[model samples]
Target: MGPEAPRHAYFVPGRIEVLGKHTDYAGGRTMVAVAERGFCLAASPRQDRRIRVCDAACGDTVEFNLDPELVPRAGHWSNYPMTVARRVARNFPGIERGADIALASDLPPAAGMSSSSAMMVATWLALAEVNALEDRPEFRENIMDLTDLAGYLGTVENGQTFGSLVGDRGVGTFGGSEDHTAILNARPGHVSQYSYCPVRFERLLPVPSGYTFAIGSSGVAAEKTGSAMEKYNRASRLLSKITELWREATGCDDRYLAAALASGPEAVGRLTQIVQHARPGEMDPKALLTRLEHFLTENEQILPAAGDALARGDLARFGELVDRSQLASEQLLGNQVPETVYLALSARSAGAVAASAFGAGFGGSVWALIEAAAADAFLDKWIQAYREQFPEQARAAVFFTTAAGPAAFRVT
Candidate 1:
């Protein structure tokens, strides 16, 4: 190792999987990219073997001795960085000669925001900067001359991150390749962008601007490396296999699909069942999409009940949809009687317009999008209602939609 020295800080964004769930692990295309929420790391090199890790939010410190011999166990978020160090060392022999790593994060665990993956990727990128490793001409540099690595470092990091987090011996990098991929940037610390197209299903190509979504959580902190993720991956893989079989049996390929989207309605429906087992509120993407579509198809009482208000030029129906969606989410999608849903319900119950769970589900938070002018009233009412229903989980965050998706920092 040269004495070039290592010292730097990086702010990396969180990733969101808007669509194409379960496809990434199968080497099939999945749409995912970093979001506004993020994690930051500040580091400086240490001459000896030790890692000084810190959590800015909670003011916690963890010092690990960079012990390669030690295997990671459950419950330690630190395992992710260690694991990245391990992989890098495997390639460059002594990449982790000596280093200090300080970490700060705002990403929520098990929120389907890829907090674990973001942390892992942030660590990898940080390591890469410190080592000043040779920049390969292509996205991934092959470890051996005989084998070529594919995709950006984030893709590789994601594969490792999810697989490591979920505990599947072989899930993410199962036959990963680097060809015809939509380019995503790998800024030293900034969020990267990827290609996003209006996925055509039954909905309009350009979704109506006024339309809003609500998300509720189960309030349970899920084990990212435990049964929940594992079950999804397993079922996802099986679905991929079935899609392959179906394609092979019939020469015609599915029209409205990428190599990944072969699992049309039936496939998504089945995936929904599997994901539901893991608790839809907690983000079984497969099942969440299934339920979302199912809502569009049936049990649309809320839309008609409350949304009909918006339709009848009546405000009450809109409020009802908000209230009704929250009730439905609590009963089906996984809002565990927390204040978020109640707040969301309050926004409608107090008469602001439509409300639903717009964030990741399972029990953490809920979202409500209402008329711009009525927003304050809605928020105030929602807060009061939420405080009454669930005293604890009553926190609110407000954000609006904009032109944001995955794109490279410097696209050629």
Candidate 2:
């Protein structure tokens, strides 16, 4: 690749998990919107099997061979693109060419805005563009649509096999398709609801007129790596353990916690009993029960009602439901930090209709819904409150307002 070479440009936006916290992977539903901020990439094909990526913002470059056996450079940002390259190489064979990609992003990294997932989606798009992977038989057979592609990409991140695509070491997070779904399938000016474990679109509700989301990054890096990875995965693992118990007790092979609970009206009570009576193993029974409680309330009660509130223009009711979701994240999921908690509470105090910390929330950002006219003042007051409370975090904290944005696409 040279300066004179023609390049394909693409943009992948970050996302806001507006209502569903830690519910996607459990085969549950979530409402999400795309952020105005995201990653932009210019990629050109290479004649050889070497993929080179340069981060324009950070001035970091990583080059690796496009091989299925490629091992990710642990803790390095390159692990994201490298994982995509490895998975693409394995899933679609006879890909002799690679790419020279230069990327830049306005989205904050590790701030729970799906920056990492956006990077992966961008890399996958670049590779797919240069190689025409979508034309491949395997790709066509497995990924029939964007929804299917999102599900497959989720597996790519979590090291799970999708259809006939074999599994490999992922970026080391046991997560789901929510981020990918929103990135690939989001509609502008609307928050979309989706269910995972074979991603399906439920419906889309237009964001109320004159309302926009103000995001306050808590200045806490919520990178799904290191100790934070364990905390994030713990929530996911609890769902898995509960599903395991459900299968054992009922003699059913439902793959996800959501599926088991949806089995019957009495499924919830039965699962709760199962969790309460489980023999101790990898997870404490008490922790399992809390996870169950959160999932039930969030997936069954709060998400649908919130969506309905927004549908009917019931902003007050919507705010109250969002508040319940936030409390569940704090009390039941145990993923909220002092910074995030304060951000949510203070945003409400600052006149946001509703506010909550989102993403894999051991430490991350919060989203506050407010009038478009008041966003600036709300942001000012919210950030001032946050900074006054935690001065050390003020330097890293970022605040912005955005409406729902479009999904990932080629920038022709």
Candidate 3:
């Protein structure tokens, strides 16, 4: 690539978890997919360890050093780009310079979508590409290098545990599951993930095509996902033990595990009870009890009243899932936000299906799963209700969707 060659920027879409909340990080089950909206990075190599970050939306140029000891803290959006530069230095050791990255994004700041991870992916890709082209005598395009860079960046940027989980290059080529957000469950020592093969995932999850997802603060959610659990080691052990029990029990009979998963199964003989079932609704408790081990294993989608849209062959089915999931998450997980609740209720009154909050709850934005045809009406209703209730603060509940997940493109 030459100076005249265009600099490349990648738009890695953030992902949404359709089912299995609080499950992924706890070694339970989860389902996530890239949302249609996300962040972008335009990069060109620099001659020093300093990466210049021009945040177009915020109109601020945050200049930071790629030194590992001086990593950025969470909620600092520039953390991702800085981490990428630092990790690259730690991995190859050959080229110790940073790059200039200018970014503008549409992904909601703190929804459960993992916008931070998406940013890492784009910055990592851009930096790697720049290195391969410019510093060739000391460079290589080894995917290992990229993965190492991502992981090191994850740790150096997000914290040590995070770097270990999703930053692995091994999973990079294959992408990741929604459960990846479970990295929140990670400790300082290690980050782990589970894999299921012959996966039969149904992806009817809707990504708000033309709209945007927004997150706001209520000042209540202060739990740092990194340090949330005091007995994380014990919890990790318990989760691991329960998972092993399922694997052994299912080794001979998978149906037993499957039936105990989604929906319900029936019919037991008086003499030799033939069915073992997991109760409907939240699957976490049953999983904790080693009674079930199956996750929804599907992508995010809107849920209409009928059923899953993909499973039902209706595009409307996708939105239906979002609507239902929002309600369920509130009832089961306790992550409900008044703002989110009000948004959904109002959206529903204005013709939306459902509305719900994101992340560890208590704060952030509301996601409304509505009929596509009713979007305009819902927005009008939300605006009106928000203005009456919170003249200044309520304006942040806005939501919408954009393009798909991150993928490599041919710049040449």
Candidate 4:
């Protein structure tokens, strides 16, 4: 057993993307808010070099010898903590400690709520505490700030971080770090507007008075391992090809869709004209134009316009933008699944002021901005309708109100 040590608990919130879903991987911007629900862990150091992990929710426990060479095992939830620990050991020299960790969560995995990212964040925090990384001068010398650490952990999962457990460098999906940012840096009652090309936080937009956010799960899991991985990779490839095409025609090397947008509406207008006449033979005949339309519209119109509406407390206008973004997700981005589309539409019809399918889409959940006073009634009606439509799925679906919460914290 490891040496006896003091115990501490940690919590890391999950994140919901309000707009600009797949755009993050292509260097576009996104709006993300931390959810109240997330993963929680209680950990203590042990004298032995063995590590034990317990998942109270799943009634599963795993034990392993602490080693820098630990690798992820398929279908095993223990891989999350093991991978984080291995990364810390591999990256930080002179760290030869292990801990017993107990994990639990109300966050639904694969619900587009970033449950996996939350787990990664919590695991890192626990390891830091047990290793005394904060107090050790050597470990603290080049220590990462919360935001940087978040992005680092994200890269670790995507198989981009140096010394990641998975040999391929990613679990499968090629995604960006918006989830990490929201999980580690979001403030309560506000949403973060960030640019991914350079990964910087631009601004914080507060929730207007009298309004709150609610998430309704479609009950279809957003698995990134199977065919979903192919679809996600395809979207990213299309975005890259579009950027290359734009550079070839306009002589702009900015690569980011946001850059083209920054050149003003006239630039976007002219680019669209060029694309129309540019010989569809070289482009992804069906997706290129639609993807460009969605990307340009999001950067040039929806995001900024929605930011203004929310800042000015114009919930009605903000709601309109939400609906429009959902349309783009379905028609242009092609990420929406039938259940998610139905949930967003049903929320609106059930009196939600504005509703959109949030997160990566193709499954997961939809978030609705609605009057606080009417939240309960809206949730009840929406869930009931969803159950009637998807009876078998109703057992797995989740619906509830949530407020923005702190990204993460140590309880003791």
Q: List model 4 lDDT by residue over 250-290, tens digit each.
A: 78886666676576658777767656666666455456778
RMSD each, Å: 9.6, 0.8, 9.4, 3.5
**Which is better, 1 or 4, measured by TM-score?**
4
lDDT of 1 by residue, 1-412 (tens): 1235445777655443322323333433332234445577766677675666677778777666555443444456766666656555544555444566667766555554455655665665556665654463221333222112223333344333222222222223222221112222322222121221111112112112443322233244434455554543443344344444445544546421233233454654553444444433334456445434433321223433432344345645445545555565455444233545554556556554444543233333444444545555555665555556655443333333222233222111
Off by over 4 Å in 1: 1-6, 15-36, 65-70, 108-110, 134-219, 225-227, 230-241, 244-361, 367-377, 395-412
- Tens digits of lDDT, candidate 2, 1-412: 5879879999999989998999999999999999999999999999999999999988899999999989988898999999999999998978998999999999877899999999999999999999999999998889999999999999999999999998889999999999999999999999999999989999999999999989999889998889999889989999999999999999999999999988898998899999999999879999899999999999999999999999999999999999999999889989999999999999999999999999999788999889999878888888888888999987999999998999998995
**Model 3 agreement with the true structure over 1-412: per-residue lDDT tens digits:** 2466357666555554434444433323343434446666677777777767787788888787656444554445665566666655555455555677777777656555566566666666666676663344323332234333333333434233232233312211112223223222211111122222112233233344443332223223323244432222233333444444444544533322222332223311210121133234333444344321212222112222323443444535545555566666565444566765666566656654434455444555555544555555666666777668666555444445322333323333
Local error of candidate 3 at 253, Å? Answer: 19
Off by over 4 Å in 2: none
Write down the lDDT of every candidate, Cα atoms only: 0.43, 0.93, 0.45, 0.78
* Top TM-score hit: 2
Q: Report the poorest 10 consecutive residues by lDDT, candidate 2.
A: 374-383
**Candidate order (TM-score):** 2, 4, 3, 1
Which segments of candidate 4 are over 4 A away from where they belong?
1-4, 65-68, 134-144, 161-168, 244-285
Q: Looking at model 4, how many pairs of residues clash? A: 9
| Candidate closer to the true structure by lDDT (higher is better), 3 or 4 | 4
Q: Residue 382 in model 3: shift from native, Å?
A: 2.8
- Span of ten consecutive residues with least summed lDDT in model 1: 198-207
The clash numbers for all candidates, in the given order, read: 24, 0, 22, 9
Note the residue pairs that clash in candidate 4.
Answer: 1-48, 2-46, 2-47, 2-48, 3-46, 3-47, 158-170, 159-169, 159-170
User: lDDT: which candidate is best?
Assistant: 2
